[model samples]
Target chain A: MRVVYDGTFEGFLTIVYELYYQKLKPTVIEKSALSYSLFDEVDTLVTDETKALKVLQGLQKWWSRKNLQTILNTFMCDSKSFEMDLLKFIRLGFKDEKELQNINHTSVFAIRNLEKEFFRHYHRMTGFVRFQELEDETLYAKIEGKFNTLYYLGEHFSKRFNNQKFIIHDIERGLAFVHNQESKGIHQVADFDEPIYSSKEEKFLKLWKTFFKSVAIESRTNPKLQQSFVPLIYRTYMSEFG
Target chain B: MKKDIYTKMQILSDSAKYDVSCSSSGSDNNYKTGELGATENSGICHTFTADGRCVSLLKVLLTNYCIYDCAYCMNRVGNDIPRAAFSPKELADITINFYKRNYIEGLFLSSGIIYSEDHTMELILKTLRLLRHEHKFNGYIHVKLIPGSDAKLIDEVVKLASRVSSNIELPSNKSLKLLAPNKTKEKVLQPLKLARDISLERTDKVIGMSTQLIVGATPESDRDILQLSSALYDKALLKRVYYSAYIPVNNHKNLPALVNKPPLLREHRLYQADWLLRFYGFNWSEIVNEANPNLDEELDPKTFWALNNLHLFPIEINQASKEELIRIPGIGVRGAYKIIAARRFKRLGFDDLKKLRVSLKRARYFITCRGKYQNEVALYPEKIRYALLEPAKPKQPTLFDINYSATTGEL
Candidate 1:
């Protein structure tokens, strides 16, 4: 049997809720928008918050807090067949709840690997994300991330830049994290206009570029080493690379 | 005037890059006072430059003008290079501005001795005063304590900065006399010892003290370097001892003339040994003794040691303690912990070790899973050494290589 659900994480949890109640053994799972193939028996699961909540509560009861967080982070990954992979993990998780903690398990290992990849990108963005000073003294930065990491980045920036107002726009994802002093908001930005830089911003950037150039030792200029640390894709928005 | 900052920054940062200590870790001071930034214990690398070096701290010299002429230094008084100095206000402004833009984690402020050691230290202290007291900037600030500076100035500098270091340029006293005439081993150790005492006495604001050693510049062996590092760590509570492979920056009759490139591989080997000293519970004698002063270029220090002492190998993976596991070449500090935690549930095989992040190919020859050897390779020291020395493939960056580069400020 094939199960189709909305792409949201809530939709995935509703499928987990159906596994216990409706006795639906799904052979394949696909997101609703991409579910075009005809199936002999098809179950399209509508996302119900109550059903999702029950599934989450059951996970907390049987699994662990870390496991729940791992699944949530895994859902945020942009890998192909990630939804189907999540379904496999959820099924195996409820089958033998204790097996969820075992790193040797194929499903648990796959989800944890996704979590590690997501967190690595998230942490790298935290350091690589540079803000340009706007004309109104607000800081504006944009990132094109592989995962939906803007959710984790907001807390880090808010705590660090408490006195400042800033907006971190995820260009590819079309989401922006707008942070003001003491309050933060995440909005879906349809179109973000080019930012106006402060007069001092350009000079600081020039000085930064100079500093970056000077700090590298000419005797040990290894491009391959540099590329390994700061991957080629991340240089697009980094001012130092320019 | 605005362009002057860039020009001066070029000279200052270029002169500063030779000192290979750009870590912003070891201290965990969160932004408690509504300051603009916070410091993580694991540290953060803002960016990596073309040299693959981490751009963590805004490593810069306050001034390239000096009174003493160190033979190995680019900014020595005798050298005919362009010299520049940043005023206290200019440096403090630059550090704060850079921090605001997330260009750096903190400021690593070092300077050449001008007029006197005390005078240079006072200028650095003033910059720290402005950042800490005036701007209330509570981010990571690593300052260089002038070797022969007054104790009062050292105390003041230590109180303001989050981390401090006094570069013991060359390892031995003979090398110090031959290269740096004005500085001595006692002068360098005095400040490091004082800073350690002061940091221990202070109840608030934890401070970490570190020092740098110029490797391959002098006639000091790896044993000599590691012994010095071990002493500094044990006696003065030095948090880190950085080793920079000598890059011939200036022509000097006293310095070692290198025809080839810098001793980066040798420097890398020293770092591996240094890691064993700090974390792996191995002493200087264990790493490199009087018989073998230099590390083998082919194998890593741990692998070399494992090969030298093959009698202890073929230990059961499940039965080995955490200490025994770490001594293995492939299992790092993290991998050792992972193995210890996972083996409690069931007996782990060679495949299980791979999942736990062990370097199975390297560990396979030494370790056995439940008394069953996974590989057909012999365990004899000569055969194992030759097997490891056989160049099978091009070197790819492993986790150990990344870990060493990150810890030792290598690209």
Candidate 2:
């Protein structure tokens, strides 16, 4: 038997809700698999916010706040064998309150490692995501992230860049997080126009460039060390590098 | 008549780069009252410069004018360099603009002593006040505390700045006397001790002071440096001590020649030892003492210690306590905790450890999986040391050598 739902984490939780109430014993769970055995039964469910909420509330009762948060964060990671492993992890957690402490368990161990990688991705992009002033004074930044961290950045920057109108577009996924200090939205777009620069934008950029250049000690120049910090993968989006 | 921001930034930051305390971690001072920028406790490094240093803060001096000529300093009063000073308004303006565009995490304001220590500190305070009160910018502000400045001024600085440090440049008292006549041990330690006491009095959980120690500038051994650091941490409640391998910036008779390059690996070793002191539950006496004055350049401080004390090794992976687990080579603080947590659920073996991504190259020799030693290498310390030795690389450090980052056993 196969189980399927929308790719969102909440969708996965909605499936988790079915797994308990409906007594599902799925051989496989996925956002959508291209193929399933013809004889295999397929159970498809749309994402239900209420069902997800119930699953979350049930988890809160069983698990510590930290473990529950880890569950959500690990789910953010789209690892291979992800859906089945998460299902096993959740099942084990349900069986024992101390399951996450059992880091030797394969499913628990995998989720824990993915949690680290997920946070590393989230933190790096949040730090490296550089904002520029647009003509009308909207702070705009872009990131070509390997993870779906655009949503995370929205919450972070909205608090960090208080009262500032801003938009952070992940051009790779054609997704943008727009915040107006009071409200926030994540929108998908096919294309985005290059923003017009503010009058002082050029001057500030030049000053930043000068600071970057002058701060580096000439004798201590280590391109490889610099490479480790600002890797090739992130250079395209960052203004300091090419 | 006014110098542009670019010229001031270049000159000021170039002078400021030598004091190498780039960390903007801990202390939740930012974002409580700021409309412009927030210093997330986990600070951001927007970029890394060519020297491979983190560009987290706008690390710059307010002015290069100095009343004291410290021999190791580039901004020494004797050096005939281009001089400029930022009006408090100018520095604050530059900081806000760069911060808005997310070029930096916050401002690291350092300055050369001019007129008096009070005058220099007041200028820094003016800049901080403008950012924190006027602009409502509550980002991470790391200010340099003037040694002989007024107690009231230092107290005000402690309250305002997120973190503070007074650089003790050279390691020993004699070296300070030889190189920097204007500075004394009490001159540096007094302000740091005051800041620590002030922060302690206000918030019991607070750690607000650090100092930078210069390596290779003088003949002070690693033992001397680590001893100083350990004492500062224990006695004065010093939070951190940054060791900058002496990169000769000035041509004073007292200082080393420019030809002797920055002791990059030695500095790397000191940092490794410092990490052991702070996190790995190791003491200075245990890591370095009378017998071994310098850290072994070939092996890391931990590996060196492990080799020296082979009797303690072969700690059972499944059964060892947290203290025993951390002492084993290659198992960092995090790795040790991971082992402790995992062993309750399952008896961890070589396979389980491998799956957890623990660095077992050196660890396999010292640790046993279910009382079974994992490595083919003999239990004898000499044999294990030879087996563990990484194939030697050239001594001459380059601009891009990536080997300097030996994990100071992950925090």
Q: Which stretches of model 1 miss by more than 4 angstroms? A: A32-43, A60-64, A88-98, B1-3, B204-206, B355-357, B393-411
Over the stretch B1-411, how does candidate 1's per-residue lDDT look in tens digits? 344878999999988998888899988757753657778777889999877888899999999999888898888899998888999999999888888888999999999888888899999999999998888787899998888889899899888888988888889999999999988999888888888888778864346878888888887888888888998777646888888888888899998776477778888898898899889999888889889998987789999998888889877879998889888888888778767767766788987877766677687888888889855688899888877777767677786663334433343
Clashes of 2: 1
Q: Give model 1's TM-score versus the native structure.
A: 0.93
| Candidate whose TM-score is highest | 1
TM per candidate comes to 0.93, 0.90
lDDT (10s digit) by residue, model 1, range A1-242: 87888778788888888878988788777776454556457878889999999988888898877777878788778644576667778778778766665666655666766787898998898889998889999988889877889889987877777777889998988899998866788999988579788999978898899999989888788777788889988878988887
Query: Over the true interface residues, superposed, what is the Cα RMSD of model 1?
Result: 2.7
How would you encode candidate 2's per-residue C-alpha lDDT over A1-242 as one tens digit per residue?
78877788788888888888989888888777768788988888789999999988889897888888877776656544478878888998888867667877788887777778888988888778888898889999888866678878888887778868999988877889998846789989887678897898888888888888888887677776788777898888777774
Task: Give me the candidate number with maximum DockQ.
Answer: 1
TM-score of chain B of 1: 0.93
